[model samples]
Target: MTFHYTRLANGLEILGESMPQSRSVAVGFFVQTGARNERPEEAGVSHFLEHMVFKGSERRTAWDVNRDFDAIGAHYNACTGEETTLYYAAVLPEYLFAALDILTDILRPSLRPEDFDTEKQVILEEIRMYEDQPAWSAYDEAVALFFGDHPLGHRILGTVESITALTRQQMLDYYRRRYLAGNIVVAVAGRLDWEATAAWLAEHCQHWPAGATPRRVTPVVSRPARKSVHRPQVNQEHMFLLTPAPPVESELRYAAEVLATILGDDTGSRLYWALIDTGRADSADMSYHEYQGAGAFFTYLCCEPADAAANLEITLETFRTAVRQGITEEEIRQAQSKLASRLVRGNERPQGRMRSLGYTWIYQHEYRSVDEELGRLRAVKREHLSQLLEQYNLLEPTIVALGPLAELAGTVFPAS
Candidate 1:
């Protein structure tokens, strides 16, 4: 495998990783813009614009674009997050150029007024669908409670009112401002002749606009507290414990991973044994989200309304136990092995390699080989996890729940 990183004369950075043994290729466009960059009223515009990108473009009708992708058997999709919007595709190595062509054309979108109107309704429906799902709604509310009005906590899918009020002109202006060459990274992975692929991008993207780089995201103010939502629509109560944590570039990230895995790994970690194994809850797990300058540690639980408080207590107690008694040597070794093994296995395919390329460039701004990444995790000492738990106070959580929890209002779950 070999890697190439270049900055074109126009300022767009093209980053790629080539593994000749792989039969598939994945390509992605990572734009450094999303809900966090939006004005207060433009909550959903970032995601809305992502939809418009595919509705049409300068040279291809929406139908033509879809048909072409289908013709090549490309599996493609796009997503909007707190800090980035990505459009990506994976296909047989032979379809690499065709996939790249379709993706590039869409990124330079048409954003027609008619297309905007239709896509707006589709997006509204998507938001509604998510609203009806308890788990998704719970996580969104948890983020809001944790970060308050901070841009990092803003909803990726803007509220119905926000999406409804958005205008085509507003979206067009946003597209121009955030989709600048300097603010975008075109990442690809798999077997491809670097010279030919680079030349193709240079020619096809020559007309791509070069604009001022977008400003850095403002730092977030974390409001560490608890809040609850009463949703009569669901049978289970959904609860999340969110805490502020280190950003993506922090070396503590490796330790954080081990911490989460040791405490709440779904297969049979502490939480699974304390909660799921005993039937205290339906499902429980812990995860970490590392944004550019903002990050969060989350523990999510779904259970009957009657079991909500009890299960939350159990989850908190598990953390306290780990902190007070210390993570066992065997547990630390197991977590490290689990995390390192995943890192090695995940990079075997182009799709996984593609994510590594995009995320490495976007957050770390440097690339580390898979072996190097595994080594970093392996090097993390048990003391590092202990230090993070003590110094940063990960045991005291900011709680958010959605369900029939009117009785729990004005009440924060006890940490003990």
Candidate 2:
């Protein structure tokens, strides 16, 4: 295996990880703009634009775009998140250039008024669809509650009101501002020729303008609060406890991930034993989410309305115990092994390796092999977890709940 990196004169970065044994190649265009980059009035434009990118382009109709990928038997998709948007495809090594051409063409979308108007309804429908899910709706609200006025808390799928009023001009303006050459990374992995790939990108992307979009990186300050929404139509309760954690660039990120797995992995975890296996909750887990300059740790549970209070207490107790006593060496060892195994297995595939390569460069501007990542995971210790628990003030979290029972919001748990 070999890694390659190149930068065009216009500042576009092209990266490739060549795996001799792999039969498929994964290509991705990662844009450094998402929900957080939008102004208040342009809330969902990033995601809405993702949909429009597929609607049509100057050289290809929407049908042509879809049919062409199908012609090559490629698996392709795109998604938008809080901090980034990705367009990607996986194809046999022979179809690498075809896939790359199609992806690059769509990046310079026509953004036709007709296409924009048609996709507006689709985006609105998507927002309504997610609102119908109790867990999804609760988690979205929890992020807003936790982040307060921070732009990082903005919804990836804008609210119905924002989508309804957003205009095509606003989206076009945003595109021109954020979609500069320097703000994007083209990443590919698997069996490929790096020199040929780099030359292709350099020629095709020469016309793209060069400039980096600046991002606001205000430090997040979280406060303890509790809120609940009554969704009488839902049969189960969804709850989330959110607190700060190590950001993407932090050295403590490895320890934070291990701690989350030890406390809340789906099976053979502290949360599973106290909640799921005990039948106190239908689902329970703790996860760490990292963004460019900020991060969050989430503890989530779903249960019958009647068990909401009891389960909430149990979850709090689990966190308090870990904070007070720290975790056992055996638990740390198991978490390291579980995480290392996942890393190795995920990298075995070209698509997973492509994603890792893109995101690592986007966030850290460096590369780490599978061995280096496993080493980081294995380095986590009890003292590392202890430091994270104290440094992040993980014991105090903003709580959000959604269900048939409004009373659950008022239930209180003791602090660490």
Candidate 3:
């Protein structure tokens, strides 16, 4: 199976992967606008808009939308993020056209006053719900500290107060600006004819409005100033260390990914053997997050309150050791192989391939074949990983910890 691409008369991108061997079609609509696009006063508008699109639309009630998809045995859902809002589904190829129609209708939603009022309450409740969870709340605080004044720091779910005060007019106004043909990419995968899909889009979307894909203002991420979050109520400690890194497009990102795996993977990872295998921590791992022109490497460690201080020191030493001694050639080869295996296994299903294509296009604005991706991962060198660890100030990290402060009191919590 391979990817096919084109554009509609109205500028909606039509992306697809021809998979004649598969029985289902995995399709998605990628919108370039998200939380970062919102102003301070309208913090949760993008997420709110995601919910409103499902509440009701011009042609179908939310129930009808669900029933129709269920009738087709469709797997459909939508999610909002800091940089993108995606609506996707997998269904029998026969139902592909209908699925696309349902999606397109929902995309251009009818923001009814009554529905907006109800959804606002629901959104506020969601905010309250997340606040109750220590991990979610802690991460939000970390982001606030990490990103500071940058729009990237804004939470996708926004705040309870912000959602509560948000008006239907404000949401409608934002929808008018951000949600349009130009900002969307329609991607589909699996046993489908690209010609038919293209014609289907031409009929449905050619009349829709047009605009260019929205671009995010890349943030200048600095080292964390005050990194600890002391939530005294929780039983255990959740600690995360952050260091700035490269974006999705940068060649160095592949190296960052390899470095992260070697440092934090479940097994054979430096942090895993040092922290998790030792039973000093409940879970510990490293992950790399990449956006348009900004990215960060995160090392997350969770452990019993009693081990907080020891675990914190161990985690720091783990990175410091990597910087000084560096990873071995054997370790780099193993990490690369592991990553390549994961990528191949993950894309075995058309749904996974569907998502990969959408994100690659949305973020990189280019298509990278599976072979190309594997080649890049394979190309990573021991020096690339070691250089990044030393070049980036991975040793002096901005730290954020949540949970009981008693056991971790003086040692883990950096003075804010």
Candidate 4:
């Protein structure tokens, strides 16, 4: 598959990946603004806006929006993450242009007050749902601990308080400010006519106002770690050990992936083989996340409250050993092969292709063909991994623990 990219004078990015012989096509619109783009008071606006768009658009009523896609058996959805919001649709190749048209309408929704009144309850329910999930709750707490008062620390599903205070005008204003062409990208894949699609997009999108460069914001710096938080109502402990790393564009980013893979990639991974297999913890894994301009790597673990300290020490020791001993050639080979294979399989679906194209377009501003990325992964050597760890030693991790356990009382001493 080859990915084609072009930028219009208005700065809207048009991206496509050709997947010959595929039965369906997927198209997506990605905006760089997400929870990280919000203030504390506007915490859930990004997600709320995502929902509102689907409720009604200029040309399509909410019922029509549902009927059109449902009639075609197409799949359409949107999601808001830390730094990006993606709207996508997957339908048979024949419906490609129609899907694109419908998506565009949704993006520039009518924002009716009736729709807002209806969707507010939905968004509030979403917040409550996340509140009840322990894994979700702990992960959010860890992010707050890692970024402190920074925008990155803001919860994606803002509190019910914040969501209640948002007015229709406020949301419309936000839409006006950030929905410009310069900050947007359109990614499409599978069977399609690039020339035709591009022409259609250019025409429909011209109504979108041109360049207004988004104001630059400073990067997040790790504050003192929040060691441990306890809610006695919980049955088990959830903990995170995080440390700073480089941005998505950095070479060290790949190394962090390799390190995370070795620690908790799968059943054979260090944490899985050590903690879970040995019954020392219920679940354990490491996650490496790279933000648009910065990165953080962490290990998240869950265990019985009594085993928290021993499990924490074990995870740290495993990581330290990997850094000092370096991964074996076989382990590197296995991890690389596993990652490559998964990448290939994941893109087989139209939805997956839409997501991959959207992600690359937003993060790199240039679409990286899947083949190119695979080659890079294949070329990664153990020496590269070792050099990365040596240069980017993240020994002083930010720790956040929650349970009835007292081990994580104050800040992890020597905040490092």
Candidate 5:
């Protein structure tokens, strides 16, 4: 991999990774502001601004944004998360410039008032859709439990009240406050003339002025918390357990990933083998989320009310035992191998490469070549795993459950 970076005078950070083997080029336009940066009153503004940008830009209408890309046989989309709003595009290497243009136009959109109202309704419905899904709602509830009143506790889509109350000026104000050149990064991977690409972006964004430096997200010490919502209408109960861990840059970060994989990574992992295979859970999985300044290990299980209590107990006990008794050499090797494979496989796609590239750039603010990352993963050992267990043991965890929980009194779950 070849890497190059240039900082625009106003503060835009542009970087690119050249992969000549692939016939496609992936480009990501990332802004650092996310749900965590918003004030309680400004809950969904960052996400809303992300949507409004695509509604129309200075050079293209919303329809044109999609139509032009389709004309070029390109794949393009955007997403907003707790820490960043990423707009990405992938196309044949020959069409790299066209894709870049589309992304640039979207980032500098015209926040029309009429479009704001329309998108607000769409977003409100999106929030409602999440409210209706038990599995999805459970994760959101878990985050709230883990973070309490912190901004990270709020939903990225925010509440209906927050979205509906937002005015065009409020949205534009957020754009001005957060969408500065310094807050943005343009990253591309797989094929391209870096010099030419940099020149093209510089010419277009040269005059873009720096706005206020977005507020830095403060790291909160998350404690354990629990919430149970009994919504009888849902057929199955959703249970989420979150354990606080270290930041992305911590030494124990990779161990946290291995632990999550051992518990509930996929169909072959412990959760699925113990619960789903035994008919204790209808569906289950665990994942690790390492943020800019913090991390959380989450284990999620959805099951019938008949098995909910037993399933929850078994899962918690399993984790506690592993942390205390230590993992076997086989389990440690398997978990590490699984995680390593996932890291490699994820980079196979253009979008995945772009995501990994963009995330690594933000987390490290410098390039970590693929070979170097793999080396770190390979060096992990069982003693290191035990040390990690001692460091991030999830004895107390934040729990969120949505279902017919009349049978379950307050379980001694973790408090956030």
Candidate 6:
């Protein structure tokens, strides 16, 4: 395996990880802009633009884009998130250049008025679909409550009103501002020659104008509160608890991940045994999400409306015990083993390796081998978990609950 990094004169970065033994190759375009980068009026434009990119480009029609990808037997998709957007494809090594060509063309979308008008309804429907899900609504509200006015709290899909009022010209303006050459990275992995890939990108991407939009990286100030929304259509109660954690750049990130897993992994976790096994909650888990300059630690639970209070109490007690007593060595060992297995297994595939390579450079501007990552996980000790629990004050979490029960709104769970 060989790793290569090149920065073109036009300011675009190309990252490649060569795995000679692999039969397939994966390529991705990582854009350093998302919901958090948008102004109030431009809400959802990043995601909307992601859809339009596939609708057509200056050089190819939407049908041609899809048909060409299909012709090469490629698997492709795109994602928009709070901090970034990505478009990626995986195909047999022999079709690498064909896949790269299609991927590149889509990035320069025409954003035609007719296509934009038609895609608006599709975006609205997508937003409505998520709104119908109780868990999704609850989490969305929880984010709003925790971050207050912070852009990190902005909804990726934006609100119905925002999308309905958005215009094609507005999206085109956003595209021109955020999709600059310096703001994007092209990552490729698997069977490929680094020299050839670099030369190809240099020639093809030379025409892209060079510039970058500066990201606003103010420290995230969290607002802690207890909020509840009454959703009559939901048969069960959904709860999301949020607290601040270390940012993605913190050295303690690996430890934070392990602690979350030990506390709320889907199975064989503190929450799983305390709530799920006892049937007090249908789903319970904890996740730590980190962005460029801020991060959030989340604990989620869903249960029958009648069992909401009891389940919440049990979940809190479990957290309290771990915080006060610290995690046992056995628990730490188990969490590390589980996480290590997942880390190594995930990177073994070309697609996964491509994503890892892209994200690492995007966030940290560094390359970390699978062994180096595993070492970080292995180095986490009980003391590290204890430090995170103390530093974050997980006891005073901002909570959001949604269900048929209205009384939960008035109920208070004090931080002890």
lDDT by candidate, in order shown: 0.85, 0.91, 0.83, 0.81, 0.82, 0.90
Weakest ten-residue segment in model 2 by summed lDDT: 407-416
Clashes (N, CA, C under 3 Å) per candidate: 0, 0, 2, 0, 9, 0
lDDT of 6 by residue, 213-303 (tens): 8797999888668987988888999999998999999888998899899999998999999989998889999999998888888999999
Q: Candidate 2: which pairs clash?
A: none
Which of candidates 1 and 5 reaches a greater TM-score?
1
Give lDDT for model 6: 0.90
lDDT per residue as tens, model 4, 136-188: 77788888888888777878888899999999988988888778899898888
Worst 10 residues of 6 by lDDT: 407-416
Pairs clashing within candidate 1: none
Question: What TM-score would every model get versus the actual structure?
Answer: 0.96, 0.98, 0.95, 0.94, 0.96, 0.98
Worst 10 residues of 3 by lDDT: 407-416
Query: For candidate 5, what is the TM-score?
Result: 0.96
* lDDT computed for candidate 1: 0.85
N/CA/C clash count, model 3: 2
- What's the lDDT for residue 68 in model 3? 84
1-416 per-residue lDDT for model 3 (tens digits): 77889987667888888978887889999888898889999999999899988876889988888898899999988999888899998999999988988988888898889888988888889999998887777678777777778888899999988888899889988887887788888888889989999888888888787876457566665764545566777878887777788877788999999999999998889888888778888889999988777888877778888887788888777777787788899988999999999999777677888888999998788887789999999998877886787667776666777887733444442322
Q: Please identify model 3 stretches exceeding 4 Å from their true place.
A: 406-416
